[model samples]
Target: MKYPSTSTRSAIAALLCCTSLVPGQTAAQDAVQLPDIILDSGAVADDQTIVAEAISAGGKLTGDILDIPASVSVVTSAEIERRNAKDIEEVLNYTAGVVTNSYGADDRFDYFSIRGFNAYTYRDGLTLGENFGGIREEPFAFERVEVFKGANSAVFGVSDPGGSVNYVTKTPRGARFGSAYGTIGSFDTKEVGLDFGDVLNADGSLSYRFTGLVRDGEREYPFSRNDEVFVMGGLSWQPTERTELTFVLDHLDRDDVPGSGGFPIGYDFDRSDTFFGEPDFNFRGTERTTATLIGRHDFGNGLSFGGTARFSDGNDDFGYAYVSGQTATDANRSFFASDSAEKVAIADVHLAYDPQFGSFASSTLLGFEASRSESSNKRYFGPAPSVSIDDPVYTGAPSSVPLFADGETEVSGRAVYLQETLDWNDRVIASFGVRQDWIDITERDLLAGSSATNDISATTGRFGLTYKATTDLSLFASYAQSVVPAGTGVEPENGEQFEIGAKWRPLGGGTLLSAAAYDLSKTNITRTNPVTNLPEPIGEIRVRGIDLEAKAELGAFDLTASYSYIDPEITENGTAGNEGNQPARVPNHIGSIWANYTLEGDGARGDMTFGLGARYSGSYFFDDANVAGESDSYVAIDAAYTYALSDNTELAINATNLFDEKHVAFGGFYADFYSPGREVQATIRRSW
Candidate 1:
């Protein structure tokens, strides 16, 4: 299969993210971090709500959530352990305005949508999922996950207007901690992990940390498997009281059979019992390494400077098969193979001033960022043997496939931004921000011996207002814009959003409740006409939605809940009769709630906790034409039970899809469109 030409721009954004590790290693926000805005005095909130007290992705760097007029969701390490998420999607399961597992049981990459549009994945504020290398990460390598809703090019120059997801890497700290764990579960799965860190010198001037994990498991599908090994370490040095520097490195190796959603031949056959493809010939292998350096210097008198840089190298090989045509029980299969290599480097630096004007304080920042990325890809597609849905025969193997596409893509981006936040009596805040960005991309079709170069530039900004009606309630409104560079000769896509919201902390700062409504639209979207089978660039679409979220600790109970409703419409489309139709595969109603209560000392089990969760997605159209009808709506239930064997030892059991609910996530897509079956696991951990 040939690679999508338009996907080339991801290389720039991906490389751009690699350069922002400075804001990430020291990023004190809930999840997403901003470059050049590193603050020396912020860390993850130590409360049970799993929400960060300060989050930069919301458009600023401050400890008070109510201070920023945007929507941000953070999931801390404490909650990560509670949820035991297996992948990135699971980490944001309870966050508002987001949906995951839309392709069912695919393990090759993490896919999800935020506010009716697909979101990009980041680590330490750098792009990972959107990279051309098809990067995949193990959740054990990160400390927390964060989500920033809506476009804010003023904060992040190039981003999806719908939203952003960021994972904070585990880094060295001044605190002492250690843990080791082992897990065994359904499908013959086995896993082990270790985490340890602490201050390495007197006065806590130096610190070190290391985290690693290994896992072996089988996918829900018959004869398929998933496995990975990952390790990461870091060192931090505070040479002076106001100066700090840190270095981090990580490596990952993985081999697995990618997941698949059988053709839309109806779900009459049992998914677990049917063999749709050649499992023996299917495989995906990956190896990657990355290093980052971050530093910040604080000058007295409300001035500071921060810098971060990162570089990464990755390689991947994949081979898979799918049904091309079929009779009642027999099917003709096709084979696809690809090998890719990618390199990315990015850096950022910024200066911030926080001048205290007595009762009227203001914080201002200016920064510059740049990134470059290059990727070489080779693709192969051909014919494979036939298979049966009932008693199958794997006689023929397509070990050789004809090369289809061979190409290389290079991308680079640079941007400068300025932001100012003014506070009046600590009760009102007005924010003004602007960003100017320039991007260049070059694509070389090696097979055809041809190359093309394209460049684009745009300016984006955000204006926001906040009013503190009381100590516990705040009302706010904001306008933000984002720009994404399309491939080849296509003009860049533009995203605009207008949002209004309220934040309330009725039960003190430890508890937060927020509601936001936004009108979001994107123009210059590239689409293909269904009838003519041709691409169109003048397409436009809109998604309007409301998000309600809560995170709080009531006595011994800590819980998070959210409900989101979105209205998606295709205002202008290349496909005939698609105008006014709902976007395919986007759900209108999405809601989820997760809570766990700790019980007092139990008879034999030290301390016990029981957790339960429910996730719901409303009906959605299956195609852009809205003629294939809507898909089945599904509600998935999850449950967990944990027992503390001792102060340092604990055992837990977790299960997802408790009832084995089966349904289609995206209809008629060759990808894994069916939801994953039931999964259960038991883990024992030792920590101090």
Candidate 2:
């Protein structure tokens, strides 16, 4: 893909040429840290470092060190490797203000919430909304993960301030080498992976990397198994110093034997209990497949472009067998049998410009994106004429019933956006942006010949300002708006957010701290009954919260801590009085802390490192009505130790959930599951 040309580049070059009029001036003397600038793919300036670059490079982006007006967190690759994080949920659990939930025995159908807003997974800055069936991400291919908290409407156009996550992928760097690792963990889990990369010539012109991983494991529940394999490869060509190109391909195949539905909250907060209708119900197994392709090009000018295409195919055939005492059904009764499939495609283009007009410096960005996704759900129910408890025999005939209707739904979206930032004297900055989007949804029932379609168009805007109060402190504020179109009978809602904060670094670059207060409100929410087709006031919601974070490096020790407080309320709703009820699943308090110490040695048995971390979350309402709630307040501890066994080999042991806190991580009336309890793994790696 290619980006359209603009005058910003030529303008910058002309200005640079005219600078010669100044006598006794040198290029080095004139070069300054360009403010409010955006560069194309590989054109990022050496002096300008963004949070995204920090993530992709396995480094830290301390709040006090960067001038970004919002709260941004980085999850480095070293941390992921230390924790042996196998998936996005595992990696994010340690992050502040993030929560995840999984249904049934499948980890592929997980849901995520960040800062009280639903922030689904994304790849290369594009949302992958087709995950309902089999669309999922493999963490091994990612270099790092970045989380931007608070409103992101200015950069992404339509995003909740609750937060947004971006996964940065690994790229080939024209080197020839190979590495391998093997791990054994709890539940008889065993995994092995190999990563190999090579350069075709000495001119640094052609290179490629191939990676593959295979895993087999069993869960803590009965009849549940995890088996998966992933493979990926990429090719790069750098024909000239000013031009570079890359193509990447990846594939994933997974199979899992269904366990019972996730563990449910018992009357007494039991993490081991399954609260569904039956215990012996069988849920069969599932199979999932995914493929992806990505392309990127960078021109040395202040501009670059990239694109990605992906397809996923999955099949899930599971039987939900339940026993009903009210109907006097047989002990072995299956209530639901279903299979599902989905497909998705996404395309994007990016542009950036940096120019100086006298003392005023500005950065401009323009982008366009389009995506299409489709999904189908087919279900079959067994026949049972037993309408009452007196007819137990009729319910025993499993094959007597007819087929049920098959349900299918398709959704697609297209969007375009523009954003610009203006800076003054490295002390003040302002940004503005706007976006427009169009979406369509369609649903059909095969048996009933019933169909429905919904279309929506919306626009959003963002504004932000930052002022340096002193050399050690900065003040910032922003306002942004977003929209989430409803599916089925629901109407779209608009979300508005305002944030004000200050960042302080008392010890200059050694220690960093930040505190922010924000308010988020949503309007035009839809509450509609699918069966009745009646519209009701869904009401508005407001979330007020404060976030605090600190990071410091002293000697050989690294320490980090963060805390967040939320008071989400339903300001207006038809079903419930506007008496400030807390939003469902949003905890009032959350916090996390981690510390790592490194030990250096001069001998062949080189260095060693030890790390410890813990996370805590407060109580939350499980239901929308707030009648029933879950006190998820619990502390989880993790410890890791790594040692270099040789010059090219290492060994490590990691233990997570050290306390075995049997607390509920996430739950709902429809599904409930406990967080994974105490798991330990040991790994051995060799590199060349």
Candidate 3:
């Protein structure tokens, strides 16, 4: 039987051939042996195994998502379709060891924390951060979402502890055409999307795809609205089996209607207090444009290379308004406004090689990346004119506020890294890699008459070992390190991590379980005063945690569950001891479970699948001092169903936050905001 082309097949075959003919080899070793047909053994049919192989191949060939040698999670297109996810946050929430928070009134400014780390958003493995909010791109154009947990300085040079999120763009495939979809839900929400793919040339070597979305919605909260439109086009050229090139152009325009500023911590739940502030505070109204070009080449002899270049420009105008007072009598209100614009450019190249030696095989990758970003933000502060309880008016003309004159910041970085994986006798594997980065930052405080520029560099490394105890069970342990330079106007810090884990599959291809324990520390962190030029030590932070996950499929039922416990603290500080007293907002307990069942199998016109899921988070503090009160723990449940109408048509219904649990995922020192309320949406789609 013929099997799919795999790097290990050739390497192993060559090794066995050489070993059998050795002069000292016995008759048993000299005998000819047949190559193992991995595909026929039902091993290559599993999604997990296929994904793992893809990752290995990618690491050895181009060092994309496959070379990181870290804990990685991939949400496939089928999973996204099954869940009917609408945004990046929705998809990431289902991933293990990830936490997401949305605080703005409209919940458009989504913030993600992964394994107690932060990630700089990327599209197609390229940086997509902006000046105002770092990142706010929609996920409608992505084919899948890949999350790399732990420190990823090797891939993204200067980043946060939250790891990184890369959205793989959807490109033209072999298909010809597709239909549009529309969804409607609570808060007068409406969303429409269209996708089309086709071969433009008779030879099937040239193809194009166009995808676009327009959405207008309102949150369950009072006085919040969102409007956004996105369009992207992709062109692909596959002139030969050995090479491929693709280009994409994307654009986004978003507007937030006027609304109440942030919600009050204590009285926000009372629907009657909706009129606490002016109803004209707009958070973000912006336009972003991006273009990317990617190319890949394969040299047949277990060697491949790829490169990508991207550019983005953005502009945004936002306002902040709030009321301060005890009761209905003496409350005073104020308004603050800011306008920002930014430009960014990035380029990256990757190369991979696979070679065989006596009784050993190795896959190696080398990569380099560089990025430049510039941004300017101007602030305006003024008093809000008082009017009737129902009516509020603008009082002062907008002008640059004193002591804060149009702050301008610029940041740039270059990085290079190498990764290698070694396999011995197809049972034991060892991986090693390292990354080096150079970062530069410039900040100008116009009002303070001061300017600062700082340059810093660092190197990080990773090592791991995996032993195949059995065909179905594998034990693995890994340690990785990461470093992040301080943002503009701040100095850099040093961070290190230690981890060990084991993976077990008791039922071979049927059930998979994994457990891990990790400890991470960071020192010499830089903290700067917003008004002063002095920099202070933020102290040392230590985080230790354990993660447990299980996935299984029995008959027609599928199950996935995960649990995590974290103890993060500040070990040393100028103000306090023991690692800053349990780093604020880092919850100690997090868990999630999801299950699905399918009905109708024997020659039915359609099939139906139903899914149920739940997420739980423990109490967390809100401030660094740990003096602020703790946010209450909460549990949320969701359900979804899909029915196939025909070979090319289907319908799906998704309900999120079924219990409408009132909880706060995150909050600032001064105020807190509630997460989205219950929402339900239905969609119909067709493909040809």
Candidate 4:
């Protein structure tokens, strides 16, 4: 038998003892100082943003939205809670230049696209892809969601040129407060959540927060379910006025049915209420754990440095019985099972200097980032008996499972970058940045007894200029470049974007309006290499779009409106037939408007608020060939009403797709994915 070492036991003992310390003691009185802390995780507090007019999406440096040359959207926690969003997809359903639910109502992932390409997910300014053991991000775990449009690889490192979404998680706070909520909704969904925060020391430095939620729910589809549990704990310590450290631990478990297989094309049945797959054996389960640590120290003299480190691990087990082809009516059913384990570690450090050089004010940043990930998967399959579409039989199929395939993959990346921003008399702003990344990938085909490794390097850059046209308006233009790694030996896909825009503070205090137009293109698309007979870059795609956004707070009304137009086409395709075709599932137009009004009630009624919103998405091609079919355009209606029971309590009801609009949200590889129907929920919340 083996036990913990003396040093390990000592550390554990010390941590246990700290929990027993009296809260009234100060650092001077006790040998150990609890440390002062700042919540909000080093991000600009929600209160500091004037009705979404200020943002930090372009760079980690917080600044006025007008100063950023790219289009950005900021969704605050207040708005998220008001709408009773259940997932990240729901939170972005109304944001501009985004298409949520691209895979319909699947819960296995937060799948979506920004502009015409996929958007990378980030937490606390760090990428959460394979580099960080990607998991389906829950909206409730975050305080805000910021969407940055266009390529940001110069600052963020390898990213989708369309954009990125940053989720700022909640943090501990100086003030002692707690809140709890209970919610019930359509589709047999029940949820309970708790959020508590408190200062741990008398000096007002050490603070901690514990937040968690347990939800049980069933999807609208037959034999489908969505249930999960999540917990997050955070601690912030400021040992000195100039130095601080924040740590967060998060865990999630998805124990119920995870995803649904879409129906066959032209099924002619209600998409939501039909079941074509096995009910007893079909399931998807996942468990993920993540830890993040952030530290910063101000060195004075206009110089500062900080670092962020994260580790994540997860396991996913899924089985599905799905369609095998597009032309099949009811004869091409298949059954498969896959089990995967993934682990990732990533870290980054940055130094910044804010100073005046001659007549120009400059803020310069230098940073380096690195990440490594390992993943393994085993898959099994068996012959599945076909079932009649009209008269489905639930009781028959092959029982033996045969190993289909197995493999392991390891990926590592390192990047160094520098960014500089200069302002001339606070009238003209110029920004430039460049980054170089080295990536290595290794894959082992266990079943085939083959292993391959590849190493690649790329450098990207970005430049922008912003002119202060007026005190409340700015005109800006930017050019950015990025590289997306395809595979080993496959030349990385390269993208470039050119954008011009204008931003205006319409009301001078609580309102903002912005409009942007951009032309973006990606080339070096991978194809089969003639020499190695492996995939290599030799394709191209182009996307152009215009976006308009407005957010404002007026006397008793809060309003948000957005409109987008995206035109995307495959300029070069390995398959000659796909050239000039519109990319699959890329919508042409999307628009939305949401408005809320608050009214003070008469003495007995309490205050009441009502909100109404409408979202529209234009129809688009569902396949690369544009021949199978096209998804139908539809409008979804959302409504909300909240009544304040007291100063610290409220009751609310929120509904989406109020009119029950039914249409295809996207087309899958073998079938068409339909949109979810109307869903309504009610919540009761209390805070201290």
Winning candidate number (lDDT): 4
Measured by TM-score, how close is model 4 to the native structure?
0.90
Task: State the displacement of the C-alpha of residue 231, model 4, in Å, after optimal TM-score superposition.
Answer: 0.6
Q: Residue by residue across 355-429, what tens digits does model 4's lDDT show?
A: 987778999989888999999999998766676666667654447568888999999999998988899977899
Model 1, span 1-688: residue lDDT tens = 1121232224323323432332222332422311221234443343234655666432234347787888878887778888888877788788899888776676677777888877766666555545223576677887667788898667766777888777777778665666667888887777777776778778898998878776667777777766767778899999898998889999887877776626435645566666677766788889899998888899989999887778999999888777666667777678888999999998778898999987999899888888999999999998887776566687645658999899999999898889899999979999989989998999998998988887989899988899999978889999999887777677888998999999998844567899999999999898655666444586788999999999887776878899999999999875466899998778899899988898969566599989999999888887888876667788999999999887667899999889998877655533225788898999998665
Q: Runs in model 3 with CA error above 4 Å?
A: 1-53, 56-69, 102-108, 129-132, 177-179, 257-260, 268-275, 323-332, 385-405, 488-490, 504-512, 530-533, 551-555, 576-580, 601-605, 666-668
TM-score of model 1 (CA atoms): 0.91
Model 2 ranges with Cα > 4 A deviation: 1-65, 101-108, 130-134, 157-161, 257-259, 262-334, 380-405, 469-474, 488-490, 504-512, 530-537, 576-579, 664-672
The residue pairs in collision within model 3 are 117-161, 117-162, 118-161, 118-162, 569-579, 570-578, 570-579, 570-580, 571-579
User: Which ranking of candidates, highest TM-score first?
Assistant: 1, 4, 3, 2
TM-score of model number 2:
0.81
| TM-score of each model, in listed order | 0.91, 0.81, 0.85, 0.90
CA RMSD of all predictions: 7.8, 12.1, 12.6, 6.8
Local error of candidate 1 at residue 134 (angstroms): 3.4
Better lDDT candidate (1, 3): 1
What is the C-alpha lDDT profile of model 3 across 105-170, one tens digit per residue? 334455667766555666776766521255466767876666666665555555555466767787
By lDDT, the better pick of 3 and 4 is 4
What value of lDDT does candidate 3 attain over all alpha carbons?
0.66
Per-model lDDT: 0.77, 0.63, 0.66, 0.78
Model 2 over residues 114-144: C-alpha lDDT tens digits? 7787774566566654234434567788766
